[model samples]
Target: MGIYGFDLLIAGLCLLFKQITQLSYVFSFILLFLSGSVIPFENLPEIVRKIGLMLPLTQGVLLGKKIVFEDLSMSAATGSSDFLWLVISSLVYLTLGVLGYKKCEKIAKEKGILSHY
Candidate 1:
C-alpha cells in the first residue's frame, strides 16, 4: 500500500510539474534517503523522525522492522494503533495522488502540454 501510494503520488507529480524528470528523480532519491532505510530512525532528530513517520513508506518500513525484530505478527500489528495510522496515511496519499492526477490530466490536455511532456 505504501509502495502504491508513493508511486501514484510521483506519477501524478510527473504529469503536473514542468521540471518533470528532475523533480521525480531527485525527489525520489531524497525521499529514500530520508526514509530511514540507510539511517536508523532513532538516530534522527526528534522532529525529523516524526515527519518521516508521517509519510507512508517510512511508516511501512518501521512496521516491517518491528515485525522482524520484535517478533510481531502481521495480524498483531493490525491491532495496534501505529499500524492503523500507517494504513490511514497510505490511504490519504492514495486519494490525493489520484485526485491530483485527474486534475492535472485535464489541465495538461487543455494546455496541449500532455504530448510535449
Candidate 2:
C-alpha cells in the first residue's frame, strides 16, 4: 500500500511499476488523482471512489486522515470497518498489481515498446 504502512511493500510496487513503464511521472499524476492522494475519498464521485479502492493509495490516504484528523489510534483503526476495507483493498491491489506489472513488463520487453526511448 502507498501507506508506507509497510516500507517494503511500497518499494516492491515501485519496482514493479518501473519494470513495466518508463512513464513514472505520468503514472504519478494518475495515481495521485485516482487514488484520492490529493483529495478526500468522500468528495470523489461514486464511480471513481469505487475504482479508487482498487489502488492502494486511496486506502492509505483514508487511513491517514482517520489518524490525523479523527485522532484514531493505530490499533483502533485496524479494528474499524474502514480498516477492514483498507486491508482487503491492499491485499487485492498489491497481489494483482504486482503480477500484472510483471506480465506487462515481459510483453513490453518482447515488443520493444521502449527500445527507442
Q: Pick the candidate with the highest TM-score.
A: 1
Per-candidate TM equals 0.85, 0.63
Q: Which ten residues in a row have the lowest lDDT in candidate 1?
A: 1-10
Model 2, range 4-116, lDDT digits (tens) per residue?
33333434344444452445556667778887877767898999988887667777787888899999999998898888887877777566656655665666567666343
Root-mean-square deviation of every model = 1.9, 5.4
What are the clash counts of all predictions, listed in order?
0, 0
Q: Please give the distance, in angstroms, between residue 13's alpha carbon in candidate 2 and its true position after superposition.
A: 13
Cα distance off (Å), candidate 2, residue 107 = 4.4
Give per-residue lDDT, candidate 1, residue 9.
67
